[model samples]
Target: MNGAQDLGGMMGFGPVVPEPETLRFHADWEKRALAVTLAAGAMGVWNIDTMRHTRESLPPAEYLSASYYEIWAKALANQLLADGLVSREELREGHAQEPPRPVPRVLQAADVAKTLAAGTQYERAAEAPAAFARGATVRTKVFHPTHHTRLPRYARGKRGVVEAVRGVFVFPDTNAHRQGEHPQWLYTVRFTGPELWGEGADPGLTVSIDAWESYLEAA
Candidate 1:
């Protein structure tokens, strides 16, 4: 038969199914962990990008392996353990423990109003001219980075058009890498299937993706 059938025949044990209660509990835990992990991950990334302190004192593994919410929970737990806010035993035993520091009070209405009036806030605005106006041609750079990059591999070296100037945004690719967060003008680049995938592409379909102006070069 197939490779899977051959393997299964060799291994006498079947795929074991958990009891309904156990399965339900695992599912619930997974959901909770996912929510926490994502929040924690965002916070960790934002903290580093913004040059602010992060509660995540642990390595990247805590964020990568945990569920979205669980990542945050793990990071929080790690922070607590590191700062002596909670002990490792407490975490392992799942016990409620004191925070390392006291929670601060929320800002009052007047304070918020004053802060808003001062204009010491951050707002993302587009900063680039739509060099290639609507329907004008452009091409994404064929960039290869040894580390991480925001450009998806599929879009590299593909020809696209300036569909719409989407205004300025904080370029995560730069800021996340500790480069800088200078405003980068954004645009929606549209591509026909043939331009991206060659003759194998379906003629009727098109793909649109949001890309920063800096990511494109003249076709």
Candidate 2:
């Protein structure tokens, strides 16, 4: 989906600035927000892709104005309400109004470390041979769907060379909509800056993106 979150080459946003890696949370509430988001995610009701879709699906105005964790918190609240785990009154009251709900798994305090260390795996066994090989030229298919997609808007309809075979992995487009994983071969596609940004871009500049097989076709 083309959301405000997909601001790549768009102008008027100002130049990108690098942030120091030393800083983690800017506020106490941010820490709590991350914990709550992770805890709710442990319910197994939705995957990461779905959570991202929900977050990015926020109204353009709302999505653009909110902060990072604000988006996460809002999206989580919406997901909770949509899943029937909480009611509007409960959310307003800040207390449970209905009986307890069952989840597939619970994240215990002791298991937090183990769970964090063992991240969920997205890679899946391939059912077919890779469609494109390293160094092969391919063009990205140009179409917009009203669902979650890993391919960015700026990169669509562009031609690039396969840089590496990243193995088969769960495709986010279908998985984000609860349609199924439908895993596909993954590849690192490298595009020249001039090809993507026109001749005005720096000739030596290049960008690489992890693209799924479905997003590319033989050039």
Candidate 3:
């Protein structure tokens, strides 16, 4: 899904301004937003890919205007509504109008530390041999999927060399749609700036992206 969130090589936006001191949250509500998102995620109603897709699926205008945490909050709300976890009226009133649905898993405060330490891992056992090896040239498939995809728009159809085999990992394209892990080989592909952007791009600049096997083909 092409959206404002995929601002990889696009122009017009000013240079990124880094904060003097990196704080986790800029405001109190942002903290709460993170907490709510984490808590809701514990229910296992959706995968991390689905959550990301929801965030990226926001309207271009709204996504551009929203802050970082605001996007998370909005995405969380959308998931809750879509999954039947909450009702539109309930969201509007800020109170439950009906009985709450029972969730299979709940995140207790006592388990927060352990849960945070054991983050979600996407890597899985290799199901088959890798199609391409290190130093092999490959091209990313030009695609505009309506569902979730990790491949960025700028790199589509571009040729790059496989730099490293990062092992098999759950394919986000299928995982987000509840189509199973569908694990595939992952690799770090290196591309010159000129290949991605126009020839005017800095020749000294090179970019590396971790691409799934499904997104690439032998060049």
Worst 10 residues of 2 by lDDT: 10-19
Please identify model 2 stretches exceeding 4 Å from their true place.
15-20
Q: What are the per-residue Cα lDDT tens digits for candidate 2 across 1-219?
A: 999888788788666687899989889999999999999898799999999999999998999889899999999999998888899999999999799688788889999999989999999998999999999999998988888998999899999999999999999999998999999999999999998999689999999889999999999
lDDT (10s digit) by residue, model 1, range 1-219? 011111111344457666666544355767776544433433333333322122222344443344434544555566545545469877888876654444233345456566446643233754546566777788998776533345666677889888897777766556744677766777789988888777677999888878877788888
Locate the minimum summed-lDDT window of 10 residues in model 1. 1-10
Candidate 1 has a TM-score of 0.55
lDDT string, candidate 3, 19-110, tens digits: 76766677899889989999999888999999999999999999988998899999999999999989999999999899989888999999
- Score every model by TM-score: 0.55, 0.96, 0.97
Q: What is the lDDT of residue 17 in candidate 3?
A: 87
C-alpha RMSD for every candidate: 10.6, 1.2, 1.1
Q: Runs in model 1 with CA error above 4 Å?
A: 1-26, 38-123
